[model samples]
Target: MKQPGIFISFEGIDGAGKSSHIEALAAAFRGQGRVVTLTREPGGTPLAEKLRTLVLNDAMDPLTEALLVFAARRDHLQQVIEPALARGEVVVCDRFTDATFAYQGGGRGFDLAVLSNLELWVQAVPTLEGDFVRNPDLTLWFDLAPAVAAERLASARVPDRFESQPAEFFRRVADGYAQRAAHAPSRFARIDAALERDAVWQQISQVLVQRGWLGAAA
Candidate 1:
């Protein structure tokens, strides 16, 4: 869909503190008079949210999990993201298709080619030049070592199926994110999540300032 809104996604392993910063970012954007749609992946619309529970808590094969996520994504895009963007609203998503690549393709050892095909089918938009893939305009990757992330998660709350996985799984997920960032350097702003929370916000703030999404003082 063609529109003027900016699509930004926050990504990281669990307990990287990315979720805590999302609301602040939204408030900052709203202060600038921008209409903001703060949402999350695996669930944005009603159906998608249901799919999210299944994908997160249910027992399923890798390919099954991957397909379920993509299905939810398609619904989410149609129901929430695309509509908001068409209205010239900023869309700040908690996670996006990248999570699938990390969780399913990297963590679960699924095929990247399969994910690629699904992405093309679900997200490609036809443009005059060619078929353009719909990716986040900016991706803030809260980069934390898996060991540190695991420690943080340990005290947070009950662990979901994905969260309950061994350290090796999270390591693979982190590696997946790193590979994606390397492949799309211009679109990713990698933040060190090992630092204090305020320090992490400062990094994000600087990125927002540089991008003209927020004022220097914001």
Candidate 2:
């Protein structure tokens, strides 16, 4: 496949406020006359959404959770992401494999090598360019203190399994994301999630402009 579309992902801890801006960004793209596919990990396609519920609500082993997330990811890629990209639409996804590494590998102490293997197996796609692993062209990582995030999450909604984890777990997850960002500095734009919503959006808009994805007027 020759992909002409752009793939972007928003990532952060549960209360980092990344989820709140995804649709707004997608709307900006839409306003530019771009076709945007706004989707989420572990829950894009029908089957994946079912897996999402199980993964979020059920009590399971660390390895079991990782496996389930990757399974949903595979289905999501095949059923939603790939098709949207093939059609030259912008695909904006909320969370992805990064969350698996954060939650499972870092927080739960699963093997990083195992997570890497799953990423390759589940995301590698055959393209005219060769065997290409599906990865976001741009990843916006919302960075916030775990305590602040916990406070935000407290009033947002009922806590799910992951959300209910202790602050220490979230600290580890944040470290995991930091490691990933350090390893792939060019692909990630770390945003301060503690900022006001408008300020955060301005940061995002600046990135879009710098990337040539949006005009200055936008």
Candidate 3:
């Protein structure tokens, strides 16, 4: 059997500070002399990035937005993530399918049954090889309150379309992550976003050590 390395995804609603954390974790792995490929979903590859801009920029029907996400995801898997993992590098993605499930399905009120069906279609897409069907080894969900997160966004200079979603939508997105964390406690790490940045990093580092990622690299 061909062995592939770990795939870790950082997941959270807008303003949860996941992007910074992903970069930090990737840097940590690189410091350990491990080959790490840092990437983000719905916008990693060239074409997917274009799709991402459209998905984030233009307002469209809810279902259309969901489809665009999966499309970009497929392209990203084929052009970036799968190839890196096949070469035995650690792939740290900023977000993955869970984001779609949470944002599109949970926040936007898309039915889970529909999302499941779409996921099935994505699995069959020829662009993604069957051997690369593996999901993330771990998902770090940065839990944040809608109000607190909103305040953080307000402090920022600019807000994206998703970031500008209604407060209630973000509430559901947070709940979506929590529900997922509860369902897959082993694979998901729930971090409190209200904590200080360094404190949150400490928690993340602890998780990496506990998972044996640090020890194995050492």
Candidate 4:
């Protein structure tokens, strides 16, 4: 049987404005009486948070970066996400495995095949029938042009390692997200991040309403 919880993940290159929308969506879910577990990847648990620090700041090769990311994800899943889902909560996570594919496999040019294996291994969820790979029931991909995203980030806070990368890197990352969405079109809803904030939010709300996750009146 499927788990009781609804898993929702927000994805995008930084400066795509996923943060505020994530909170807004969580609030929307709460308004509908769902218990929302708002969390993030690479840092949900104590061990994962420590790994997040290392991965974001320390200079590391593609292999090391991918390893640390998956390691943190494994811990986050075991400690936070899995439990929340099992308890029938709505887990609205800031990012998920798709970020790894977009950043490591695309931005850093890591091996996609290797990343695929890690995704399979780390995301497996056991059931009576067999183990199934866990993924978000819905993934909101805030699609934006790399240049536009960069412009938005210019006046933002200090950059992280990934955020400090060149425009070409973000281009590759955007392509990566496109590839992922194409591969799983049924699960992903692309939001045009270039739109005004209110328009973007309308798209988000429309998606949720269409999916029957929220009431039309909500």
Candidate 5:
């Protein structure tokens, strides 16, 4: 396979509008004549999609849950992400490894060292075929308060198990993302999600333009 030019990941607490934004962003990329592949972690393939249901459902243990998440990710990378990237397409992921680190490691208070070990093991899988994969090229972190996010979620029809978690749990996850962004500012763009929809899009648009992703005429 070949190396991709860019890999972006959108991450946020529940109801942060990442799904909507990722779709818009992919369209924007297409406008620039870029081939973009949009996928989600814990999904993007048949087996991984099933793992997503298991991970988000209410019956898995913490350790088992963490392992399952990584398992899906490994398959996602081999079958979907890496292949797209190797074809020189821009892979815009809905969520990525940071999710597990935040939700399971930080919110659930799992050992971070264990998370690292799991990543190492997964990356070494033979099917992975020696991908020099670092983290995402850019991580768009939609920053929003847990209370606000929960309020938005309440307006939606079905709340998943993660969304059904306590406010404090989501709060911890939000903080975890902030801390991660602080540690890797160059790779993250923390968007203020408390703003109105257009305002948030404007901010994102500005970032895209400044980064030479969106054209001045756009």
Candidate 6:
């Protein structure tokens, strides 16, 4: 069988703790001898990284933000993600298109229709399966209440543009994630981040095992 490798994306609001598990998951896959490309969106490439910096720091309207993000995504896909997948490497990314929908579309109250059009354009790529828009095979969304997330991020570090937003903004972002998950029930695995650390890891690992990405022993 022809294998195009696996793509997995981790998503959540800033304080949801999804970033903490990405390296561990990459290590788990690496232990199984899979080549894992652990990276992040609005990054993963030099040009995209520059774009990420602007997106995270500079003040801009929602439309500009959305455009910049999609532009970064296009570069990321072309330079990093697609090539890695074609080489049969597991591409574990910290964020992807879903983040745009959540942060810009939801948090900024941008028109979803415009974002949708941008998604359609930026995500379209030629794959082993033929021409289609590329998306994560699995998206692990760390679901946390806005209040809980706010409390967690309270003193972590100086806030970025997105991180500095009020809790109400995060609530909308969470709702956006819910909407996305509902639309693609098969692709999303909602991780309850309120659980203890061990429990949260267990949930993530079990889901990977269930999906045959990791061995039962992992």
Most lDDT-accurate candidate = 4
Model 2 / residue 96 / CA error / Å: 0.8
The lDDT for every candidate, in the order shown, is 0.92, 0.92, 0.84, 0.93, 0.84, 0.92
- TM per candidate: 0.96, 0.97, 0.91, 0.97, 0.92, 0.97
Model 4 lDDT per residue over 10-111, tens place: 999989999988888889889988889999987899999999999999998999999999999999999999999998899999999999999998998999
Model 6 C-alpha lDDT per residue in residues 1-218, reported as the tens digit of each score? 54569999999988999988999999999999889999998888999999999999999999998999999999999899988998999999999999999999889999999999898888898668776888999999999999999989998999998899998899999999999999999999999999998899999999999998899877
- Model 3 spans with C-alpha error above 4 angstroms: 1-3, 124-133, 216-218
What lDDT score is found at residue 122 in candidate 5? Answer: 76
lDDT of 1 by residue, 70-149 (tens): 99999988889888887999999999988888889889989999999999999977768998788899999999999999
Residue runs of model 4 more than 4 Å from their true location after superposition: 1-3
Per-residue lDDT over 139-208 for candidate 2, one digit per residue giving the tens place of the 0 to 100 score? 9999999999999999999999999999999999999999999988999999999999999999999999
lDDT of 3 by residue, 87-141 (tens): 8899999988888888998899888788877777674434444433446889999
Deviation (Å) of 143 in candidate 5? 0.4
Arranged by TM-score with the best first, the candidates are: 4, 2, 6, 1, 5, 3
Clashing residue pairs, backbone N/CA/C < 3 A, model 2: none
Span of 10 residues, lowest total lDDT, candidate 5: 125-134
lDDT of 1 at 46: 95
Residue 105 lDDT (model 1) = 80
Q: For model 6, which pairs clash?
A: none
lDDT of 5 by residue, 1-218 (tens): 44346889998998887777888888888898889998998799999999999988858778998999999988888898877867888899998988888898778888888987887777553445664445788898999889989999998868878888999999889887877788789989989998888788887878888888778655
Q: By how many angstroms RMSD does model 3 differ from the true structure?
A: 2.9
lDDT score of residue 135 within candidate 2 = 91
Model 2: CA > 4 A from native: 1-3
